[model samples]
Target: MATFSLLVTANPHSSQGQFSAIQFAKTLISQGHILKRVFFYADGVLVASRLNCPPSDEYNLTKTWAKLAIEHDFELVACVTVAMKRGITNAAEAERNALTGDNLDPAFEISGLGQLTEAMLESDRLVTFG
Candidate 1:
């Protein structure tokens, strides 16, 4: 089975990119392929925000991605610089930066772009959804 890395570069709510990434990951897993990593960059960092509460009738892509990461043991990483710039802060960063509270979900980690590069190097395929 091919090992895949998904690079997300769009907002979850604004476009279909985030949903597409999630679906692709799920399909790959179902087909017995491995999802090695999910790298959130640019506006895609919003997927890690715990503050994202989609309406009851709407599909919550953030939660979906988080669950998938936890269930399948895929590395869920967000670019620290991009996340901070977009106001998406994890517990540690929030405390260090004296932010109001932790807005990032625990399912994802704030990391550098090197993780993305590593995923690309390690995985058999690097697919981008944006």
Candidate 2:
């Protein structure tokens, strides 16, 4: 089984790529492959936002991603630069920036490009979705 790391650069709600990435991750895991990490960058950082409230009938992308990560024991990392720029920040970042609150989900971690590089170096394959 191949070990894979994924980079997602698409917006969770506005783009289809994000959904595809999620499906791909699920499929790979079911097939006995190892998904080491999913690094969210660019518009993909939106996936880490806890404030996302999709219609009740719609797919809860953020929650689904979180659940998947927890179930599979993989890392879900959002690019710190993009996430902050997009107003998606963790408690630490919000406090540091003097923001009123943080919208980043607890299930996701804020990190830099180095994490993505490390995932690439450690995994057998690095796939990009966007």
Candidate 3:
């Protein structure tokens, strides 16, 4: 089976971007293909934020992606630069930066763009869902 890397760069509330990413990742897993990584960049950093509390009726894409990553063992990485700039930092980063609290989920890691580059190099296909 081929391994794929998905790069998501759109905001979490954008229906097109969020649904498309979830569908793509789920389809890849269902097809027996491995997901090497799910790299969140730009506004996509919002997906890693645990503070995101959408309405109960709305689909929480952040939780959906987090669940998928935990279940499938895919590396879910949020771009450190983008995430920090967008105020989506983990406990350690928040502490280091003197931020109030950790706003990012544990399922996703804060990493550099180098991780995305590595995913591109290691995977059979690199698909962007923004």
Candidate 4:
């Protein structure tokens, strides 16, 4: 099975890119492929925001993605630069920044762009969604 890396570059609440990426990841895994990592860039980092809440009837994109990551061992890496600029800090970052609290989902992680580069270099395929 081929190893795959995914880059999700869209805002979860503004477009369908996140949903499409989720489906693609699921399909690849179900087909017995290996998923290396899912890199969240730009506004895509919003998917790691614990503050995200859709209407009761609407899909909870953030939670869905988190659940997928938890069920599988795949990494959900959110770009720290983008997340900080957008105020999506984790517990340590929030404390350091004197923010009220952290809202980053537990299933996601904050990291640098180097992780994205690593995924590209190490994986057999790199798929982007935006």
Candidate 5:
């Protein structure tokens, strides 16, 4: 199985892009593939927001991603710049920006663009969902 670096650039709940990405990632892992990172960029930053609360009967994309990341031991990295622009700050960023709260999910991390570059370099395949 090959190593993959998945990039997601769609809103988690508004469309099927995020759902497809998650399903593909699961398939890869189930098939014995290695996922290096799941990078959230553009509108995809919404996938990492801790404040995302879908309807009771709906599937929670953020929670699904979190559980998969933990279960698979893969990195779920949200683009720091995009996340900040969308107000999806973690504790450190919120403190630096003087925000009253932070909402980035604990399952994911905020990182620079270099991490994305490195993921591509290390991965055998780069998959994008946008």
Candidate 6:
């Protein structure tokens, strides 16, 4: 079984790439592959925002990603640089930056590009969606 890492660079609500990536991850897991990590970059960091709320009838990719990660025991990491620039932050980051509040979801972590490099080095395949 191939060990995989995923890079997502698309906005969750504005693009189809996020959905495609999610489905791809599910399929790979079902095929008995190991998912090492999923890195959210650029606008993809929005998926880690706790403030994201879709309509009751619409699909919530953020929640979906969180649930999937919890079920599969994989990491959901967002780019710290991009996330902060987009106003998404954890408590530590918010305090450090002197922001009024944090909106980053608890299910996601904020980290640097080294995490992405590590994922690429450790996984058998690194797939990008955007």
| lDDT winner | 6
The residue pairs in collision within model 4 are none
Clashing pairs in 3: none
Q: List model 3 lDDT by residue over 46-94, tens digit each.
A: 8898888999998888889889999999999999998999999998999
The lDDT of model 5 is 0.94
For TM-score, the strongest prediction is 6
Model 1 spans > 4 angstroms off:
none
Please say which candidate is ahead in TM-score: 1 or 2.
Answer: 2
Candidate 5, 1-113: lDDT as tens digits: 89999999988767889999999999999999999899999999988988899898999999999999999999999999999999899999999999999999999999999
- What does candidate 1's lDDT look like per residue over 94-115, in tens digits? 8988998788888989999999
lDDT of each: 0.91, 0.95, 0.90, 0.93, 0.94, 0.95
Q: For residue 112, give model 2's deviation from the true position in Å.
A: 0.9
**What is the Cα-based TM-score of model 1?**
0.96
Model 4 lDDT vs. the true structure? 0.93
Clashing pairs in 2: none
Better candidate by lDDT, 3 or 4: 4
- Candidate 5 at residue 82, lDDT? 94
- lDDT score for residue 119 of model 5: 98
lDDT of 2 by residue, 96-116 (tens): 999999998889999999999
Report the C-alpha lDDT of model 4 over 30-75, residue by residue, as the tens digit.
9999998999999999889888888999999888988888888889
Candidate 4 Cα misplacement greater than 4 A, ranges: none
**Per model, how many backbone clashes are there?**
0, 0, 0, 0, 0, 0
Tell me the tens digit of each residue's lDDT in model 6 across 7-69: 999998789999999999999999999999999999999999988999999999999999999
